[model samples]
Target: MAVYSYSKLETFKSCPLRYKFTYIDRIKRPGEGIEAFMGKRIHEVLEKLYADLQYKKQNSLNELLADYESRWKANWHDNVNIKKEGLTQDNYFEMGRECIRAYYERYQPFNQAITLGLERKVVFFLDPEKRFQMVGYIDRLDQRPDGTYEIHDYKSSNTCPEQTDLDADEQLALYQIALKQAFTDAKDVELVWHYLVFDKEFRSKRTPEQLEDIKRTTIETIMQIEAAKEFEPSESSLCDWCDYPDLCPRRKHFYIIESLPMNEYANETGYTLVNKLAELEDKKKALVKEIDGEIVKIKEALIAYAKAEGVDVIRGATKKAKVKIEEVEKYPYAGTPERKELEALLASAGCLEDVMKASLDLGKLAKAVKSNIWSPELIAHVKKFAVRETECSVTLSKLSERDLILDEEMSY
Candidate 1:
């Protein structure tokens, strides 16, 4: 038996495939793209500013951004496709500087307040069955001489929602819960969702009834995750932020490709393809649009070739068109040349042995695959879990046991 954290538990809750990719396969996500990195960089600068108040010194927003510029840099991309990725660091720094200034101009007027901790890496056990690791470098935690704890999370996202969105977010609840756990001696914990964009703020709370409602839903989510048939997506705008967009079956085209037959490739899965010749009449409108694009492109290309070669071109010319350009994709498991090549590549990369030997947890295997996301920091985060990053929600077949950790003796 091994321990699990709330994030690990939540991974199972959100999507099982992601959990497997993160935990079982031991794959790591590459650094989050530009927007995330910039937000993080700005947060670090603000954290530093608040911390510096201990020395009785304050820097203006321009000075802070200038400091970031003094150390920031940029890069370019030159990769072949499929795995091609890049970042625009100069653009990021400027955005970061702008966000920093706006946040600063809003908060600079407030008194030099008490800061509980900035950039605090807190590890607290909510319960033996629910350990959590919170990396919220809170912007500020002020004590009102009356003794109430405030939890503030910084945001740089566009389109800040109204009270309704705050009422729906689980993070504010989770953060307050974590704050309560961290300051065990404190009596009350209040949460403040601070949106640095357009200088917006909202507060949320759990009345006894509201807390019960949240509890019931959260537990239901946990149960649903434990009984899921697959790693379903959380499914929302959040999908855009996900690093594994292609892996998700929730997206429209990806779903069509996965769940439906393409063109005339029929299967015996009871999902009939072109079974109704009558349906062709219904699709005549769509067919017209398709022909206009696909057929017109070929006709235009041929006309351009005739013009370039000095051959006389004719309007409405009747020409034989190629039906297929190049379309021969092989299955992942079917014993084809493509499959064989992939198997060889996997073997060369040591992934073949891991998969063939079935030495990994199946649930986690269901979660994620990060082909190019293994950074050192991410590796550390994934290894922190006792369970593989995550497992299949519906069924957990692979169970690897760990040694029971012995407790240490106390010094008298």
Candidate 2:
């Protein structure tokens, strides 16, 4: 079995079926988006830049871009989505020029770079007959004074935050682990994510725990992939953002698994209460879902009706409408003194049940209205939106309420 690289592990995690296409089948996807092209181009530039730095060769922006432009053209994959025929010579040059400009502006000012760049595609055949193929590259290795190695990869496109968006990235983690094999003397290795876009750089660091987790997860995933009968697509919100959604079969497999007959639900307790609670919980969730879906449908229809008739139900404080900005407002309704006096008089006369029932009616109206995602049009006609904020209820008297503020404040 071959030792998997950080790239393969990342490919599998991104979308298993897509991963299978590129890595397993070795299909070259066409570059359509600037993001895809720029990332690869940036990688090439960084690899060359750092390689030069390692050997103490000072490289200028023009030279770096020239090298990167050449690499981009040579390594450009024939993506089906790419209208490569339409790309004029001028267009390609302009694209390359813009890419290099962005890169230079981002990195040139930095007097000290932790690591200039890295290259990881260097192939080393271990076996005498070259049967066992092992290919790896240490693009740029930054040896810190503390004797720890900071493994870094360069990227282009829009710069993304490392700590905020890439704190849990497994690619960085796997790279950390892989670097150990390349450098035997380094006792500790640190993973760093560096993104450069339009001359701005964003950096992030990875922990030892995360690096170990990547190693374990990648090994397990690789084993599973090798043993599996098929590589199924993961159908998630991520599917919409994926490039290979049309080719994946994860959704079809879901329907297959859902249709198959299954045994009854089991429990470790083996108690009747467990079964009872399970049944009730499932039923409650289904009912809630149905109610929520229907309510959303109706609300959308109502919004459509209002729009077609050219009537604005929601009156903004100003002349022009707020135009769907997320607004958080505090509303206070003044209590009538006469009404409270009358209610207190009624309570004194032992007619409190009637008043209490009226209050409950208000509650029922709120519950009836509150169900799903709150739309502005739905809140236009009424101030009472059923507020079933998440609450932990042990007993009727022992309740802890947690407000789920979706911004639109309504009582009921």
Candidate 3:
């Protein structure tokens, strides 16, 4: 069995095709997103900060920032892509420095917890069978004086998520499961996230039940990946940062056309076809408006003719039109006061299920009430939601009444 990481699971969820490319085929892509590169440098610096603390040597803020800068310079490559259009390497470099500065100022002494591990590799099984093994590297693990353990993660995201999102986060919570499995003293472990860009700390913990649920769901996802025969691409906002655009079916054409000259790209078959289709669509829209006007007039004349002739059917050359006029039970539209009152009445009467298919299926409810399925009093109460309206509809059919042949001609 392959060792799964949170990142691996996330990749599969984001795009199964990408997952297959990265993990199954193990395709090597050169470029790294600038955001990820900046994050790596920050993690290395923080790891150094805690590693030094373990040696009874506390590095000053300047020393840490200097280390970060050196690492940033050493690892900087031409392939680092800045996806955001206006941002440059210098912009992200400054942002990284600011993140380090904010973190240093907020937690100066760094004595809140005892550093136990830095960039620690933890591998553990999610179940007793040990079939579904998982692996992760903790950025820092610390123990408080009160014997509570903390699994810390360093995040370099440009945007800060809400606390509710943190509560639902699975990365550190999975680490907590690993901690509990690996150590006897892991009863009270906290999941901590250092949102470096925001200079904020978000903490979360998992109940035993929650941990079990996470384990079960994670296994289910693993099984799904193992059983998948066709890894379909899932397009999202993250496609801009994806490395396999040249390989992805959805993005391959765009990737290939990206290097073409403007004139050639504009004249490309696919591009020309799309432009032509759009032009036709615009013309079709104008024509549809004119056609709809003609249809309304014809319908009104047909209804008037049917009423005058006292016949529902009107004949054309090869088609016949059947006009229907009937009283339809109309219910109050959704979100209306009358709809709400009726829903409340149904709830009180314990018949909410009869009306609710997914939401309130007003059509179903209307039929039930109109059919007198409910008591007289209840039906009377539901009447406020009901209004009768005469509706007219016209349907066209073949003029020959019982021509039940599959084809126009009989085969001998």
- For model 2, give the RMSD to the true fold: 20.3
List clash counts for every candidate, in order.
Answer: 17, 10, 0
How close to the true structure is residue 240 of candidate 1, measured as C-alpha lDDT? 54
For residues 1-412, write the lDDT of model 1, one tens digit per residue: 2334456666766667666656565676654655565566667677778778757688876778776665443322232112214534555565567777777887784463466767655444333456223333445665555676666677876667888888777665655555666787556656677676567778776554565465456556555555666664566555555556555555644434555556533553333544465577668978899987996676567556654665443223222222212232222443556556545654565554444434333233223233433344533433333233221111112222221111112222
lDDT of 3 by residue, 1-412 (tens): 7899999999999999999999999999999999999999988888888788888898999999899899999999899998889899999999999999999999988999998899999999999989999999999999999999999999999889999999999888899999998889889999999999989999988999999999999999999999999999999998998889999999999987897899889999998898999999999999999999999999989999999999998878678899999998788778898878878889999989998987899778878876888899998878866788999988889867444342345543
lDDT of 2: 0.54
Model 2 is weakest, by summed lDDT over 10 consecutive residues, at: 391-400
Poorest 10 consecutive residues by lDDT, candidate 3? 403-412
| Cα lDDT of model 2 by residue, 89-132, tens digit | 44655655676666666656433545634565444332345433
**What C-alpha RMSD separates each model from the true structure?**
30.9, 20.3, 5.8
> What lDDT score belongs to each candidate, Candidate 1 first?
0.55, 0.54, 0.91
Top-TM-score structure, candidate number: 3
